[model samples]
Target: MTKVNVIGAGLAGCEAAWALARYGIGVRLFEMKPKKFSPAHKYGGFAELVCSNSLKAARLESAAGLLKTEMEMLGSLTVPCAKANSVEAGGALAVDRERFSDSVTEKIRNCELIEVIEQEVTELPEGVTIIATGPLTSGALAEEIRKLCGEGLSFYDAAAPIVTYESLDMEKVFFASRYDRGDADYINCPMDKEEYLAFYRALIGAERVQLKDFETHPFSVYEGCMPIEELASRGEDTMRFGPMKPVGITDKRTGRRPYAVVQLRRENREATLFNLVGFQTNLKFGEQKRVFSMIPGLENAEFMRFGVMHRNTFINSPVLLNADFSMREHPDIYFAGQMTGVEGYMESAASGIIAGTAAARRLLGLEPIQLPKDTMTGALCAYISDPFNDGKFQPMGANMGILPDIGERIKDKKEKYGVYARRAVDSLQRELDRIGCNSNS
Candidate 1:
């Protein structure tokens, strides 16, 4: 059996190696964990969940949900592990961070066909390979990657602040998830109109660390993970409608919905630490302490970790790779994950599935699966490789707009998304059946 090399055991790399191994191919899965760690990584485990733990919405009508469905259909490793180790998080698929990574790491290690290499890979290896080193590809490997894919584009991704649950004022903040769909799993910090306005003002004016010290390329902000303060600079009401939107639950004390809300989601299975949902920021340490403390229930909160930003790099995929995520100039080489311009965590994993499966098929002398354009997985693949976006490629997440439209105008947004999901899944199933390579089979 032919052996393949897969670098970085993050979500994407793990999925890629799993795909190849499951398909009866031997794999060398390289991870720089216990030996070395990235700025965002704390655990020496595969598929570490950093930034945030929530895998977005779990409803099929949502883009993230639809994307995960497609990934599972194609035999995803991470999605199933995520569901197994999932924690209560209302409508979203959230997980206990350490447990999730530990599960993935255990699975990868136990796979007989996958040989786990514990050192860093400095250069692109010969033969078939998949590079999923992610947005924070280290300096030496990143330079090696640039030797083929240009200098690439970079931006900053921020992580939300977490506080010890014991430090929160339970009297002021009540537990309830959005829309009350499931059991109350989130800690809600309700704010009146005056409190919201005051906090918004402070957030926008907070001092931030200068980006000049960190960036070598021109500054470009990825909209999906835009720093909370930067998002606030867009408009005062942005955060109100975005992360702080007070649409679902009524305050237990007032018996009426507050003007805005700051939600704290459980960060670990123990429920001792919670992170502010959608509060990723780059404010200076003191500024973060000052401004974020203004939230009604967080006045005396003890900060476990302050929100911090780190530089991220992604290749201009359209200019360098094919739809299957293999380099056009170097067909034997493949790229997956956020570095391939597929933005969210699941999206990155989906790319790995594509790259690994496609590589597996190629080695087995089977034709590559050019997934139907209507599927969320296919749309993301297309978005990253379409030549029309050559010089101006930007990272994209799974969304209905990227998928070819349903072709009928439906005034109801929910109904429209429902139709989109159904169409996509049906199309994807037919394609996978014809290919003879789905997880269920």
Candidate 2:
């Protein structure tokens, strides 16, 4: 049996391990927790969801949601754990952090094909390996990765908070999707002009957590999701136009469009957990609760996870990695997770799944598989590995825009997404068949 070592038991690492284990590959998994822990991860469990518990939208029209659906099609353990441990806010899958991690860790540990090592890796081992160390990679191995990846390695990533569903005061909040396009999954806190202005003032005044001098980098926001505080600083109405926009939503009580609306969506399947929509921030925990709670329905809100801004590290994938996430300098090693310049939780795991699958096949004298370019998975890979010599490469999350446009463009945004989803599924199925992966199984 071939031996495969996976560095870092994060979302990506665990996913990679799971994928490889399913392929009958023996895996040596490294986890630096319990022995040593990062600033965010407190528990010693595998696949710990340290940031927010909520996976994004469940709709195929939504990119992250589509990615989750794709992961399910590809046989992801994380998605099923999320579904099993879910607490319903509405449609989005949110999990109890403790249960989710525990379940994943248990499953991985019980697998006879996997051997978990409770220490940090000082260097990349010889033979087939996957580096899914995630964004907050430790200094030692990170240096090794930097050596192989060259100047593309970087530090500085931020995240937002997640709220428990039961803690919210739904009496003061209304349930409805934007423009009523979907069901009532979003918990909306309607704001009058005065209330909106007041929230804006407080948000601006909220104290920001300072970063270390070494961690300072230029402020580059991920276009898919921008931090709430950054949005506020852009302009007063930025929030209204961005996350807090009230265009499609009306206050059910008044039957009028709110001046601005703060939306919270279900984080899990059970409808017992909720997360603030577009509320990722760098505010201090106390400040986040203090100011965010001032929203009408959240006066007594209890946050399951507080908004956080931490240093997220990654390499310039386009310059350093092949479409399979192998460093150009070292083909024996592969990269995965946020470290690959693919943002968001699902995107990271999906990358790991593919990388693990590819690595397993390669060790067995099989050619590496590339997802079809028409699929989001393939599109993300192509984007990061674009051959253009120009230095500009943006970290991307799953989005329809990244996928090849269909020949017949549908004017309706939802309909257009449906076509893209169908094409992606079809394209993915062909790749799966070629790789002997059965979606039904």
Candidate 3:
């Protein structure tokens, strides 16, 4: 039987190992936990979510939701596990972090085809291998990856803070989605112009945590996860236009849209913990608590996890990888997760599924799976592997902008996105059939 080594037990690594095992391929899964932990990690389990627990909007028309739907059709391990552990967060899929990780760990451990190896991998192993160490990859392993990918690596990424729901002033906040489009899942803390300006001033002036000398590398902020303070510094109204924009939501008390709104999303199923949506930051913990409390409902908020900034590394996939995530120079080696430049949790897991399946097919002497370009997963693969993107490539998450626009114009944004979602699902189904792959496998 053909055997493969999968490094890292993150979402990508576990998914990759599971995919290979599903195909009757033997897998040696590596993890460095309990023994070694990254600066951002505390859990000793596989597929631990170091950032926010919410998987983003769950409606099919939304990009994150569409990508997740595609993953489910591709026999994803994480998506199903996440669903099983889901908490109510309006329309978004949120999970109890510990339970979610425990579930994935249990599934991987029980899979006879996959052997879990608990040790830090420093050097790139020989033979068929899949690397999915994720963004916070550290020590000698990061060095080995840097050697392979050359200068195409990043080191800075941020996460938002989570607060206990009991601390939020319910009288000052209300639950509602923009335009009432989805379930009233988001908690909105409305702020008038004066409150907005005061909070904005405090945020921009708040002290940030300083990076170590070795950690100080030139960084480009990925637009998808831009830090809240950094975004606020761009201009007085920059934040309002970005995360705090009060475009479609009306404050129930005043029956009018406030000047700005800070949205809190559920972090787990119990609705006891909520994170500030789009509020990734690097502020000092004290500064975070001080400045963040200026928001309407968060004035006395009790924090569960303060927002943090960490090094996130990724390769120049356009130059290094094929659309199937196999290396250009070495077909036996593949890369997945954020390291392959697919940004979100679902996107990283999707890449793992592709790489694992691709590696399995190669070892079995089966034809490659030709995913349709119209599909979300296919488009992400295309973006990362297209040679034209070499010099200008940036980490990309699933979004409608990456998909080929429908030639006919549709005035309604939701209607247009709905069409994109349906088209992608149908196209993916056809491709799966062509490759003789089972979505239920």
Candidate 4:
């Protein structure tokens, strides 16, 4: 049997090693920690989490929760470890950082099929390999990756919040392009002067997530990546002059120009999800929901992803990688974790599980598992690798908006999400059962 080389001992690397080991494949897991650490790392243990401890909501209806559920069904090594080391964080699965890392390290060390190498890999190894080296990939290895995949593109973590198209109040919003020059490609939310002022005030006052030490990497804002709130805070009319400019747009409801307009651009080809144009923000998730909902036609908007601010370096997965996390040109070389453009802790681990298993299946002369698009894990995989997002790819975490619509509308929010979650679980199970992976899982 061929041995798999798993780089980086973070969440994704550990999961990949575990997945490969489960298939009776020996794995050489590498970690630079204890000898060298990325600027974001501190502790000398595997799977060290530098960001928030919370793994998000535990309820199945939520996007994060749905993703975690699918990972567990796929025989995840992180989800169970997370649950065992959890703290009381209300609905979220928060863990003791040190204890969680210790647990992961212990498991990896004890696994007879796995070996840990405590050195930085400056060159890509020959044969099968999975690179889970995270977002803050730096030094010689980053250069090698850059050489392998061309110059990597970066977004500076200034992404805007995305909302479901179904959640928009159609009666209050109109579809139109600026000056009617292009197709009615933008969803226009016209706001009166009073409404605009109120929203502006709320935005400046909304709570923000303070950046962690790792995130505060000389981050500075210019026109391109400025937060909406930062734009608003400049002056009372700054937003109106910038992103909220209502110059060429007319409100169909009033048959006249409005004070200001917020535009929602289609995110995917299906138009199921739309991102706020020029509304990049660093506000906390709850604060974003509260503040952004103030826009006309968005009073009941369901956010699929919140605006986040950080200094992350990720490869353009849509261009270089396949949906299964393998390089298009070189299927044997896989990339996982944040570096592959999947955001959040569990999402990274989920990528590892797929990449690991995909590699394992190939080694065993078996067909790779084709996770259905309806499943959260599958949707995430598809999202990062879809060619439609090639040029404008951004890191996406698990979100219900990325999934296909249920086709039938359910009035209650909880009920709709519940339906989405249930469908995902069912789709995943059917595939696993069909592939006869349930016994090992």
**Top candidate when judged by TM-score against the true structure:** 4
User: In model 1, where do residues sit more than 4 Å from their true spots?
Assistant: 152-310
Q: lDDT, candidate 3, residue 440?
A: 68
Give the per-residue lDDT digits (tens) of candidate 1, residues 1-441: 668999999999999999998889999998888899976777888999987899988899988899999889999999999999999999999999999999999999999999999998888888999999998787789889888776655455666887867668888999998788898999999999999899999998889977643452444556776789988999989998899899987998899999999999875434656789889888998998899899978988867567766566888888888899998988899999999988789999999999999999999898789799889999888778887666545566666666665667776767988999999999998987787767864
TM-score per prediction, in order, is: 0.69, 0.68, 0.69, 0.95
* Per-model RMSD to reference: 12.9, 11.3, 11.5, 1.7
lDDT of 4 by residue, 287-347 (tens): 9999999999999998888888888888888889998999999888999999998989999
Candidate 1 TM-score to native: 0.69
Which is superior by lDDT, 2 or 4? 4
Rank order (by TM-score, best first): 4, 3, 1, 2
- Candidate 3 local accuracy as lDDT? 0.87
Residue 375 accuracy (lDDT) in model 3: 90
| Model 2: lDDT to the true structure | 0.80
User: Between candidates 2 and 3, which one is better according to TM-score?
Assistant: 3
Candidate closest to the true structure, highest lDDT: 4
How much lDDT does each candidate structure score? 0.85, 0.80, 0.87, 0.90
Predicted candidate 3 versus true structure: per-residue lDDT over 205-312, tens digit per residue: 999987643344555458978999999999999999999999999998899999999999865434656789999999999999999999998989877567877666
